[model samples]
Target: MIRSVVFDIGETLTSDTRYWADWARWLAIPTHTMSALVGAVVAQGRDNADAIRLIKPGCDVAAEWHARRTAGQDEYLDETDLYPDVRPALQRLRDAGLWVGVAGNQNHRVGDLLRGMKLPADAIGTSSEWGLAKPDRRFFDRVAEWAPGERHEIVYVGDHPANDITPGRAAGLRTAHLRRGPLGHLWADSPAVAAADWRAISLHDLADQLTSRPGGAVPAPSM
Candidate 1:
C-alpha cells in the first residue's frame, strides 16, 4: 500500500501565479512581456537562479512585489491560501493511513506561506532548507529518509515535468502531474494520464496507485 504522499508546494497546492502576474502589472511591466522573458530563459535551459538573475532588478523587485501583494506585510500572512480541495484531500490521505508531506523549491518565505495556510509543520519540506531542489536525486533521497521504508511506497505530486514528475519517477515513486497551464508541450512525449482539480481526484487516487503491485503503477513517462 502507498505509505506516503509527497507534494510540491507552489502551483500544486497553492496558486501564486496570480500574485506574480499582478505584481508584474503593478510594476508597469505587462504580464505577457514578463512571461515571454521567463519563456526565453526556460527555452535556454537556464537554472532557477540564472533565470531569476536574467530578469533584472532582482530580489528588490521581488520583495516589492510581495510587499505589495501582502499589503506591506500588514496582510502578508493573510495573502496565502490553500488550493480549493487541498485541505480535504490532505485530511483524506491522513485518514487513510498514508503519510502526507510536502517537498518543494521555495524561498525562506515558504514557511510563512505554510503557516498562513495552517498546514501541519510536520508534513512540510522545502529545497531552500534542504539545500537541494527538485529534479535532483538528493531531494528525493531526503524525502525517502523522512518517510522511511520502501521508496516505491511513496507517491509524489507536482506541477513541473522536470522538477516533479521526472525526478520522482527516477527515484522509484509513483508520480502525479497537476496540470495548470501550458505544460502539455513539456510532457508531450509522455504517455497520457488523467487530470483533476484539487477536489476531483483527491488523495485517494494517489493512494490507490502507489499501493498497487509493481508495474501496476501507471507510467508517467517524461514529456
Candidate 2:
C-alpha cells in the first residue's frame, strides 16, 4: 500500500509566472520574450534556465541571484502562487492517512516560503537545502531518505517527466505524472508519461485516484 505522497513545487503545486516575470523585469526584457525563450528551451528538451543564458550570455545565474538578495530584490512564493486545488488535494490525501510532503528543485528561499505557508505537508525541502537537484538519481536517493517508510510505499507526484516521474521511479517509488503546466502539457501524450503509475489532470484527480483505490488504499504494485 502507498503510505506516503510527496509533491513537486513549481508548476505542480504553484504557478511559476511570477517567478519568470520577476526575472524578466530584472533583465529588463519583456515578459513575453522571456516566456517565449522558456517555451523554446523546454520544447527542445533543454533546461529552462538556458533561457536566461540565451538572453544574457556569460551571465552566472547563481551569482546574479546572490546579487539580487544583497540588493534586497529577493522574490519569494506565497499562498497566492499556489494552485486552488493544492490545499484541498493535500488535505484529502492526509485525511486518508497518507504521509504528505513537498519537495522539488527549488532554492532555499523557496523552502523558507513554503514553510511559512504552513501547508498540510509534514515535510518540505528544496534542491538548495538538500544540496541536490532532480533528474539526478542521487537526489531521488535523498528523497527516499527524507520520506518515511519503504520506497515502494511512497509515491512522488510532479508535472516534470525527467525530473519527477523518471527519477522518482528510478529511486524505487511510485510516480504520478500530472498533465498540468508547460512541461506537463508538452509531454502529455509522450511515452515518458506512459510508464507512470498514474496520469492525473490535477492534484484532485490524483488524490481521488489514490484514495478511491481498492480497500481505500493505493494498490500495491506488482513485483
Task: Give every collision pair in model 2.
Answer: none
Worst 10 residues of 2 by lDDT: 214-223
Candidate 2 lDDT, 1-223, residue by residue in tens = 8888999999999999999999999989999999999999999999888999999998898898888788888977878899999999999999999889899998888999999999999999999999899989988888788888788888889999988988898889888888888999998777778888888888888888898871233432221
The lDDT for every candidate, in the order shown, is 0.61, 0.87
The model with the greatest TM-score is 2
Give the per-residue lDDT digits (tens) of candidate 1, residues 1-223.
5677788876677765664465456556777766666666655656533434555555565565467657653222234446666676677667666678887887656756675566642467678888987779989888888874588777677767777777777777766776543342444334433321111133344444444432344543333
TM-score of 2: 0.93
Give each model a TM-score: 0.70, 0.93
The 10-residue segment with the lowest total lDDT in model 1: 192-201
Instruction: Indicate the residue-level lDDT of 57 in model 2.
Output: 100
Tell me, by lDDT, which candidate is best: 2
Alpha-carbon deviation at 83 in model 1, angstroms: 2.0
